[model samples]
Target chain A: MNLVLLPEQTDSTIWQINDARQVSHLKQHLDVKIGDQIKVGVLNQARYLAEVVEIQSNQMIVTPVEQQAIPNKLPVTLILALPRPKVLRRLIMDSVTLGVEKIVLLHSYRVDKSYWQTPFLEQLDHYIQLGLEQAGDVIAPSILLEKRFKPFVEDRLSVWNHSQTTFVAHPYTTDVMPINFNQQCQLMIGPEGGFIPYEIDLLKENGCHIHHVGNRILRTETAVSNILGRLFCA
Target chain B: MNLVLLPEQTDSTIWQINDARQVSHLKQHLDVKIGDQIKVGVLNQARYLAEVVEIQSNQMIVTPVEQQAIPNKLPVTLILALPRPKVLRRLIMDSVTLGVEKIVLLHSYRVDKSYWQTPFLEQLDHYIQLGLEQAGDVIAPSILLEKRFKPFVEDRLSVWNHSQTTFVAHPYTTDVMPINFNQQCQLMIGPEGGFIPYEIDLLKENGCHIHHVGNRILRTETAVSNILGRLFCA
Candidate 1:
C-alpha cells in the first residue's frame, strides 16, 4: 500500500496525471501532500522515486526520477492443478511474488466443476497487475490453462522430458527429497485431495519422479508455497 | 486424522504404554471400538497396519502387521520470526506436517511483545503431536528460541554456517531469484512488516545472502510454504 502505481506516464515536461482514486486514498487515508516523495513502480519498468509535482481536484501529478531495477525471478516453471477459484486467485498472486517464470493451471479429477467458470479467467491481467503492484515488479509470468489433464500430460510433457529433473509432489510414496538442485527443473502439484492413484501412476510412468514434502496433507495453496520455498532454497 | 501414532513397542509382542490423552481422543472423537483396524506409526519405526487387540475402559491395545517407511521430509531448515500466537500455533503444526527437521523461532523488531507470553509455547508438545498425527512421523523437529537477534547471529549462527547455502528473503532486493539449491540450507524469513534495513544489513554481514520471491508481498506463513516448495522442487 505504500508504493503508488501509475498506468502510463505522460510525455509532457510538467506531467499532469489524474488520480482520483489515489487522491482520495492519499489525502483521506495516508495524509500525503504536495512536496512529499513516494515510491512508484511503473508497469513493466523499474521502480523510481516520484515527487508529488502538483495536487488538484481529484488529481495528482508526479515527477519520476532515478529508476531502479527490479530483482530477478526464480528460474523454475510451476504447473499446478487448478484449485478453487477463490484459492486460485491467491495462489496466482503468491506465485508471481515468488518469482516463478511460468504457471500452467490444469484440471484434475478432484477439481470442482464450478471453479472453471470463474470470471477471474477473463481478467487475468487484473490478477497479474495486483501481484506486480505488490512486489513492485513490472514483469508478469506467463499463465496458461489446461482444461483436461490427460491430453496435456501426453502432449505437452514431452517438452519437460529433456529437463534435468521433473518432480510430481504427492502425499504418499517414498522418494528422496531433492537437495542442491542446480539444473533446470519442472514441478507438478496436484489438486486438494491430491492426484488419484491412477493419476500418480500415469505421471510416474511418464518420467516424473514422485516426491513427498513430508507426511502432512497440505491444502493446495500451502503445498504450492512449501514446494516452491524448498526447491529454491535447495 | 487418518493415521494414528503409537509409542515405541516394548518386548517382541506388546506395545509399551499408556497415553491417557490419546486414549481419550480415540474414544471420544474417533469412536474407536475394540476391533477396528487403524493405521499406526511407531516413533522412528515404519508405519504399520495394526489391528485393535483389546479395548479397556481407559486403554486401547493394537498389534502391528506390516512395516512401511514414511516418506522423506523437506531438505531445508526454516528459521522463522515468531508470529502471533494463533499463527505461531498453525506454523508449528504445518512445519511438522511438511517435514522440516528443525524450526527456530527468533525475535524480530515487528514481533509483538505480547506474543512472548503466549500459552502456545507452554503447550508446544500438543502442537507437535497434531503435526505428527497428520504426517505419520514420530520424530519431532528441534525447536529453539532466540530472544535477541544480534547475539544469536553472532554466536549460534556458526553452527548453521556449514556448506549449505543461507538465504534471507526480502521484498525489495534486485538479486536473481535463487534456483537449484544445494542439499542442506538455512532460510530466514521476516515478520509482517518485514526486516528493517539495519536487520537486513546485520544478517547480510553475518553471511546470509539476500533474496526475493518476486514482486508480491506474502504473509509470513505463505512465504514459508512457498520457499519450502521451491527449494524442494529445485
Candidate 2:
C-alpha cells in the first residue's frame, strides 16, 4: 500500500486505525513508531502527511501534519465481462490500482451463469474494500451489474456516457488503438472465449469502434490491465 | 489453448499427441473429432491447419492441411527485478503471452535474495511452455539472469542491445511516455518495493530515460502487464 487510507474520522486532526491487517502492516512492514511521519489519505479526499501520535498492539493514532495534492483518476469507464470468482478478486484490485473511474460488469454469451451466483458478487463491498486498500485510494469506483446484454446495449448504452470515445476490443479488427489518444474512453472487453459475432454487431451498432491489441491471445485479467494501460497509462 | 503446438515431425505431414492435458483440452474444450480441422503450430516454426486423422483413449494423430500465417512477435525487450516465487511463475507466463522478445531478471537492492533460490527458476521451460499454450505461440523468449546489479549495469548493459530505446519506470519522474512512440523499446521495471535512488542513478548513467505511469503505485504483476500494454499493445 502506497498511502494509508482511512475512513473519514469525526476529528479531522487525528485518525485512529483499528483494522488488524492495517495494524500488522504498520508494525511489521513499516516499523512505524511514535512521532514517525507517514503518507496518509482519507477516503475520497486529499492526501496528507501524518505523524504517529500513539501506538499499541491493537490500535494506533496519527495527527495530520500537512495536506498533499491528490492526483486525478483516469477518465475511463470500463465495461467488462464478469470473470470467475478467483479472477474477479484480483481483477477488481488491479483495476482499482490502475485508477479507473468506473466499471460495469456485463453478462455475455460465454460467461458462466454460475459466476453470477458467487457470494463475492453479493458482498461486493468487501472486495472493493480490498481493492481500495491495495490501491491506497479512498474513493471506490461505482460498479454496475448488467445481467441483460441486449437491453443494456440497445436501450441504455445509447443514453449513457457518449461524451467518451467508445471502444470494444475485438481480435479480428485490423485497426490498432491510436497512440496517446487523449479523450475520456469507454472500453468494452469480452469474456474468455470472446463475444460472438451477433454480440459484436450489437456493440458496433451502438457506436463502438473495434480495436485489436496484437495477435497473442490474453486472459481476461491480463487483457483488462493491458487495455487500460495501453489506453490511458501514459 | 488457441493453437496445439507440437514438436517438428520427421514425417513432415503427421503429428501425434500424447500429453493427457492436451488430449483432454482438445476433446472437452474444442470437442475435436476425427477429420476436424484445428489450428496447429510447430515449436519455433510455422503455423499450419491440421486435420485429426485418428483418435483413441490416450493418443491422437493429426495431418497437416496447409500452412498458416504466423503473427509477428512484439519487438520489446523487458528488464524486470526478481519478484517472489509465486508471482515470478505467473509473471513469466504473462510476459510471454504479451509477446515480449527477451527478458532479464536482474537482482536489485529491494529484491529478496531468497527469491533466487526458488526451484521454479530451474524448471523455467515448463512455465514458458504453459505461456506458449496460452498465447498460441511456439517461440520462447530467452531469459538472462543477472545476480549482480552494479557489474551488470556497468559492464554488460552498455554493450548489450542499445539499439532499442531504453526507459525505466520510475514514480518521481514527471515525464510521461511519448505518444505513438514507434520504436523497439527496452523497458526496465523495479520489484515490489521499487528501485532505490542509487540504483535509479546507475540506470540513468547507463542511458535509461525514466518514465512514470501515474501516481498510483502498482503491484509487480500488474505493473509488468500494464507497462507492456502501454509500450507495444498498439
Candidate 3:
C-alpha cells in the first residue's frame, strides 16, 4: 500500500498537485488525507517525505522533509528480442526496477510481426513512468528498436564491442555464461523459441560469447531478468 | 527451422505419448501430422527424435531416432514465497526451465490469503508438464508447500540448512549476494512487497545469510530466477 510516487510534484513551496485523475485516485483508491505524510519525487530530483499542507478539489500542497541520496545504476546494457506485447510490458517494468541503463528491442526470426504493432511502443512514456514510480528513481533507460538483426549485429553492436563483456543467452549451448565485473557488459537474449543457428552464429562471429544459463529453457522475459540478475551479482 | 530434434533417439522403439490435452496441442496447435518428426522424451530416459507413426485423438505413437545425454540440474534449491496465482504460475514454470531440482512454496507475511485458493494450484501437474515439454526433459522436480512460515523455518529449515550455504534476498542490505557457487546451496526469496522485517530477522537468526542483488529492487519472481541463474553458474 505504498502511495509514494514521482512526477506528481508540480512546484516548490506551492506543490501544485492538480491532477484530476490522481485526485480521484487519492480520494478513492489510496484514501489520502490533507495532513498525511507521503513520499514523493520531482523528476530526477531528490526523493522527499512531504507533509500535506493543503488539499483542494484537484490540487494539493506539501512541504519537503529532506533530500535523499541517489542510487547508482547497474553496469549492464540489455538487448532483447522483442517479445509479445503482454510480456514486453512486464519486461520493461522489471528492467527499470532492476536499474538497467539501456534496453534495445531487436527483431528476431521467432518474433511475431503482430508484436511490433502493439500500442505499447506509442505509450513508451507511460511504461517508463510506471517503472520510475515503482523504483523511486528518476533516470529512465534509453529504449532502442533494431528491426534488422544483421545490421544491428554488424553496425550497432560494434559500439558496445569495447564493453567489459558481451553475452548471448541461448539454451542450446553448453558453455556457461559468466559474469565478470572488469568492464561494462552488453547482454543479448533471444525470443520465445530462441535464435536460430544462423543468428546465433552471427552473434558468435561478431564477438559475442554464447552462454547457457542451464539445461532447461526459459521464456524471453524470465530469461532477461534472470540473466541481468546473475550478471549483476557476478 | 532446425529440426535436428528428431535424430537423438537410441534405445526405445515405441514412443508412448499420453496426456489427452497435449495430444490435442500436437494435432491442432502444432499441426503435427503422421510422418512428421518431432522431439520426444522417455520417462527418465533421454531426449530423442521421433517420427509420428500413429496420431490418435487422445494419444500419439512414434519411433525413436537416437539417444541424447541428460544434463545435470542446477546446484541450488529455491524456497520462494508463494506469489499471487498469475505470478506463481510463471514462477513455477520458469523455475523448472531454469533447471531447479526442488522448489518449496512458503507462506509469507506479504502473501495474500486469496492467492492460496487459485485454480492454478489444482492444475500444478499440468504446469510442470508444460515446463518439461518446453525443456525437452523427462524428470520433474519435486514441489512442496509450507502454509506456515515460522514453523517451517523453525522445524524444517534447520535440516535443510547445510553449511553448503544459505541466502535470503533482501533490499537495503549491506551484504552483496554472491554469484559464484562453491557448493550446493539453498536460496529463499520473498513475496511481491518482500518479507516483513520480522520474517527476514527470523530467517537470518536461523542461519540464513541476508544478501541483496543490488541497490535496484526487483520483483519476487525476477529475484528468484536471477539468484538461481547466478548461483548455478558459479
Candidate 4:
C-alpha cells in the first residue's frame, strides 16, 4: 500500500488504522514505528505525510502533516463491453490506476448475458478499493451499467459524447490516433469476440471513430490499460 | 483463439487437430463443418486459410489454401524483473501478444527467490503458444533469465544499449518519452516493490535513462502492457 487510506474526521487530524490487511502491510512490509512518517490519505480528500504517534497490536494512530492533492484523473470516459468476471476484476483495477474519469459497463451483441450477473458486480467497492490502494488515490471513478445496447447507444451515449471525441477500438479501421491528445474523449472497447459489424455501425452513428491498435489482438484488460497509457501523457 | 495453431508438418499441406481443447473450440465455438474456412498457422511459420476436409467427435483434418507471412514483430526488447508465478504467466502471454522481440527476466533485490522455481517455467512453450494463438502470429519472442542484478547491469545490459535507446521505468524521474517512437529501444520494468535506489543508480550508470509512467504504481503485468503500448505505435 503506497498510501494508507483513513476514514474522514470532522475536526481532528489524527487517524486510526484497524483494517487487518493495511495493518499487516504497515507492520510487516513497511516496518513502521512510532514517530515514523508515512504517506496517508483520507477517502476523497487530500493526501498527507502522517507521523505515527501510537502503536498497538491491533491498531495504530497517526497525525497528518501537510496535505497535498492527488494526481489529476485522466479526462477519458471508458466504455467497455462487460468482460468475463475474472478479467473484469483486473480491468477495473487497471482502469482506475490509469486515472480513467468514468467507466461505463456496456452490453454489446457479443457480450454474454450471464456475464452481467456475476456476484463480483455487487462488490464494486472492494475492487475499486484495490485500485485506489494501488494508485494511492482517494477518489473512486464513477461506474455506470448499461444493459441494453441499442437504446443506450441511441439515447444515453450522447451524455458521454458531449464535447468529447469518441473513439472505438476496431481491428480493420484505417483511423489513427493523433499524438498529444489532451481533450476529453470517450474510448470504447469491445468484448472477447469483438463487436459485430452491426454494433460497430451503431457506435459509428453515435460518433465513435473506430481505430485499431495493431494486428495482434490484446485481452480486454491489457487493451484497456495499454490504450489509456497511450492516450494520456506519461 | 484468433488463429488456430497447427503442429509443424514437413512437405504436407494437411494438418490434423488432435488437441481436445482445440477440437472443442472448433466444434462448439467456431462450429466448423466440412469445407469451412478457418485461419491457421504453423508454429513459428507462415499463416494459412485452412478448409476442413474431415471431421469427427475428437479430431479434425484440414488442408491449407495458401501460406502467408506473419506480421513483423515490434522493434523492442523488454527487460523485466521476474514477477511471481501467477503474474509471470500472464506477463509472458501479454508480452508475446504485444510482439516484443525479446524478453529478459532479471532478478532484482526485492524479487522473491522462489519465484524463479515455478513449474510454469518448464512449460514455457505452452504459454507462448497461447500468446501466438491469441495474436495470430507464428513466431515467439526469445526469453532470457538473469539471476544476478549487479553483474548483468554492468556487463550484459550494455550490449542491449549498443544500438537501441535504453529506458528503465523509475517513478519520480523527469525524463519524458519521445512521440512517434519508431526506433529500436530496450525497456526495463522493475519488480512489485520496485528497484532499490542502488539498483536504479547502477542502471543509470550503465547508460539507462530512467523514466516514470505516472504517480500510480502499476502491477508488473499491467505496467508491461501499458508501457509497451505507450512506447510503440499501437
Q: Which of the numbered candidates is closest to the native, going by highest lDDT?
A: 4
lDDT of each: 0.74, 0.82, 0.75, 0.84
Fnat values, candidates in order: 0.67, 0.80, 0.67, 0.72
Alpha carbon lDDT at A12, candidate 3: 65
Query: What are the clashing pairs of model 2?
Result: none
* lDDT (tens digit, per residue) of candidate 4 on A1-234: 678877666756768888888888999998999999998878777788889999999899999887876877888899999998888888898888778889999988888899989998987776777788788888889999999999998897765666678888877788875555757888899999899999888888887688888778888888887777677764
Q: Any residue pairs clashing in model 4, and if so which?
A: none
Per-residue lDDT of model 4, residues B1-234, tens digit only: 888887787867778989998999989998899999999888877899888999988999999997776876888889999988888778889888888889898999999899889898887778888888888898978899999999898888877677678888877677765555767889899998899999998888888989887788778888887787778864
Give the runs in model 3 whose Cα sits over 4 Å from its true position. Answer: A1-3, A8-10, A14-36, A54-61, A162-165, B1-12, B16-33, B43-46, B56-59, B162-164
- Model 4: residues >4 Å from true position, as ranges? none
Model 4 / residue B90 / CA error / Å = 0.5
- The TM-score of predicted model 2 comes to 0.95
lDDT of 3 by residue, A18-121 (tens): 65765666677667797887766676666677788888887777788766655577777889999888877788887877778888999999888888899988
TM-score of each: 0.69, 0.95, 0.87, 0.96
Better of 1 and 3 by DockQ: 3
Looking at model 1, residue A179 earns an lDDT score of 55
